[model samples]
Target: QAQIVELQKQLEEVTRARDGFQTELEQAQKSNTELTENNRGLTANIDKLSRAQHEMLQRARRADEALRVLEGEKEAADRAQGSANTKLATQEKQLKTFLEANEALESDLRKQMQRVALLERRKLEQEAEQSTIEAYYQARLDEMQAQYDRLLSEIDDSKRAAQQEVYRAFDDNAKIVPPSPGGGRSPPGKAR
Candidate 1:
């Protein structure tokens, strides 16, 4: 009975050792599984972070290009505004010149109008003088024509009186001679 008791105790101790080894092995296997799951989670998070970083870089590049484009547009707008201002200034100067020229032309027109009025007055005065001279000449011509007619009538009367006196002289000087040999004065009776 003593030998059997010693053998049973030894057998129990051996079984307990076996049970402890199995429990320790099971715990190690559970830890290994948990560690594998953690490693997988870590790998997935790293891949997500990498993808987010790449997207951020691409967004930054696009923002830089947009900024450059906006800067170019702003510069172009500034240049256009400058050109418009220059054109406006040029137009203003031209308008001023045109106004000055128009004023000068108006002044010249006024001077010409005054000159024309003066000339018209002078022409009227000259016409009046010419008419007066013509009237004086016409009166002189009428007087000369009357004197010429009187002289012609006086010359015709003198010619007729001279012709009558010549006839009377010729009748008184003529004498009648006798038919006999002796010449004697003819009597009022008939000659024998």
Candidate 2:
């Protein structure tokens, strides 16, 4: 009986171990099902990512082509700008030359005008001096003519006085003469 009891105890222990193993197996199967569902969702996400990557690649190619066209336009514009700058520099030099010439001409004109003014002043002074000389000579000539007229008048007065004195002397001598013989008798060579 004691041996039989020992054998029964061993069988019960084995039975408990088997039950524990069966529960462990069921839990492992449930965990596997969840892992499988997770894997399917991951695969669907991978498919979406692949489509997005293809679209992005196509857009990148088109962007590169547009960048090349814009670069070519920029090069043409730079060439045009260089030519315009050269022309502007040449025009500025010509303008500077023209301004210098104009200034020189203005300076020369001012000098010529000053010379003309000086000559005109000299001419006016000379004309005034000539007029003064002419007036002085005319006054001297008038004074000389007045003195000559007075001298001629004095000579005429002296000649008339001498003639009158001689007539008076002849009358006085006749009054003082003695009676001729026989009151009207003829003197020698007298007609009777």
Which candidate ranks first by TM-score, i.e. highest?
Answer: 2
Error of 1 at 64 (Å): 55
lDDT of model 2, residue 176: 66
lDDT string for model 2 (11-112, tens) is 455555545554554555454455445545555554554554455455545545554554555455557776666655554555455455545545554554
Backbone atom clashes (below 3 Å) for every candidate: 0, 0
lDDT of 2 at 21: 51
Instruction: Name the lDDT of candidate 2.
Output: 0.53
TM-score of 2: 0.41
**Clashes in predicted model 1:** 0
Model 2: lowest-lDDT 10 consecutive positions: 143-152
lDDT of 2 at 156: 53
